[model samples]
Target: MLLGMRDDEEMGRITLAQVAERAGVSISTVSKVLNGRQDVAAPTRVKVERLLEAHAYRRTTRSAREAPLIEIVFHELESIWAMELIRGVENVAKAHNAGVVLTESGTRHAPGPEWMEAMLQRRPLGVVLVFSTLPTEVKQQLRSRSIPFVIIDPAGDPDPDVPSVGSANWNGGLAATRHLIEHGHRRIGIVTGPEDMLCSRARLDGYRSAMTMAGLEVDPDLILFGDFHVEGGYDRATEMLSRPHPPTAIFAGSDLQALGVLEAARAHGLRVPQDLSVVGYDDVSIARWASPALTTVHQPLRRMAEEATQMLMRLRAEEPVSTRLELATSLIVRKSTASAPTGSPAGRGGARS
Candidate 1:
């Protein structure tokens, strides 16, 4: 039994008074730590956290004044997929008659301390994060307040400790590469996302697998890391096209980067699909609007967000939810890709610049 627990008290319920007494602190101090007040010293916070963890403390009741709001935090609000994710969260929040609060805070890893403090003050019904991982302190703060959170991780890498939703990044990469191979692209180049992200690595591995399966040589020089943006795509594509034996097809990894590839091809006086076939990932809204459309991988971004929001609701209701959910990705073929050009270099077992 806990030091301050009475025999008549509930088995798992620990009151603030009991926790305060055990920690040798006043009730107000405990309250400050619970509310994520910055005034609390680091040592005091750590001590309180340890005590709370040991006792398995959980806030059983929410204040009546707390608004019916669901908060969605993003590292970058300007991302192309942000609107789709926001719409998904809004759809679920509307069904529950709850307002959706959107905040752009923190890095790709976790929300910052300022965001955590403000979130505790708001005391939303639940939270939806567009990050792969959360700091231990952030996780503890949310759990201590009984604030459920779910991550919509597009990176295909999820934190083992939390519930997350992602898509099949490896499958998407394999599908994209195979599609190019089917179009007779023997010498294919890939501009995958950043090197540090697992999704990028997974996709690159998938590309490699497809190439090996197709009896194609995986040239190191044909592979480039991109920032998943237009400029990165353009720069990488331009460099590849400049090579003596340029690839017949280029998988730009992202729709925005694919757009860059198209721009680079145009600047080099190369016609898309005719001179250089292009493929992209993430069939976003602008994919179909592109000049020749984009042959890309369709990542279920909105569905992932919707599922993450639903998981939050399940968590709030004390219902069972999967720790991780990975959705399937499909190839969306459009006008941008075609058979490798003939007579130039494709027929000669090489690629044209």
Candidate 2:
């Protein structure tokens, strides 16, 4: 439709009204008939179809396409954080006067060598993978085909040699947990990310490291697993809270999980910070307004994304690039955490360690 297409000034572009006038029919009649609106008379549909072919107006939009297109492929389209990641990719791509072809992997049909071959044949400016959902074989196929690409959340050994970027999630977990510990809390709990995700594993390691460093006993019973989602967090939180001796300070690996924990807290009639201290990773926008402002670890989302895509552009320009980029993570201390209750499992009631 001309409404969503490009046009040339010199062509004296035809208008729908003109088409209607030329066709000797009312504007609505032409639109309904041409659009197959189902409300048009059978004879009117035939006349509009004929007139459309005669005008050769099929290609309604026109534009001077100058920039080259770069393919930005994501592992999955439905991930909660993919949109922000995409916006970051688009920011750099558009700034450099390049186009972006967004596609995905991990569906009913897995990617294969043939798909990689087709993508290589196009010779895109570069490939930016938001995440690696494809199998190792597919990745190797892309590499062997000499395709240029960078990994954001790279999957297994996702070309340790190529430029890769992501949140410093391990440090995020450390910071989140350390904040609770520093506030005189000992019974700290952790909700881990997916077992297969290196990010989640790193975060879990950080949590254990922080606990070990503080000389606090890491109770395996206090740790749970979630898939980095609100619902997962909700389920895990409910399950953990059902325990006879629940933790005094719970650290969720993501903001959504933290939200789920908040709901779970309400379900159990536990007030945040008053009865339980909570912390979350990923200081998303909603973290600010949660019942008690969330004390979360902040992932440098905009900067990380900007830097990653910018690195992709640099690679396209034949510039030498580093293979690994580690961004810093920080704690955004808010209202959700407080000193451990006098009788809480944290050290308040225990003998000196």
Candidate 2 C-alpha lDDT tens digits along 197-311: 7778888889999999999999999888788788888788877777776778899988889989898888877778787888988787778889898998888765666778887
Residue 1 of model 1 has an lDDT of 17
TM-score of 2: 0.71
Cα error, residue 97 of model 2, in Å, equals 1.6
Q: Which ten residues in a row have the lowest lDDT in candidate 1?
A: 1-10
TM-scores, all models, native as reference: 0.90, 0.71
lDDT of 2: 0.70
Root-mean-square deviation of each candidate, in angstroms? 3.8, 13.9
Clashing residue pairs found in predicted model 2: 5-61, 6-61, 6-62, 7-62
Clashes of each: 0, 4
Global lDDT of each model? 0.87, 0.70
lDDT of 1 by residue, 292-339 (tens): 899999998888888998998888777789999999999999999999
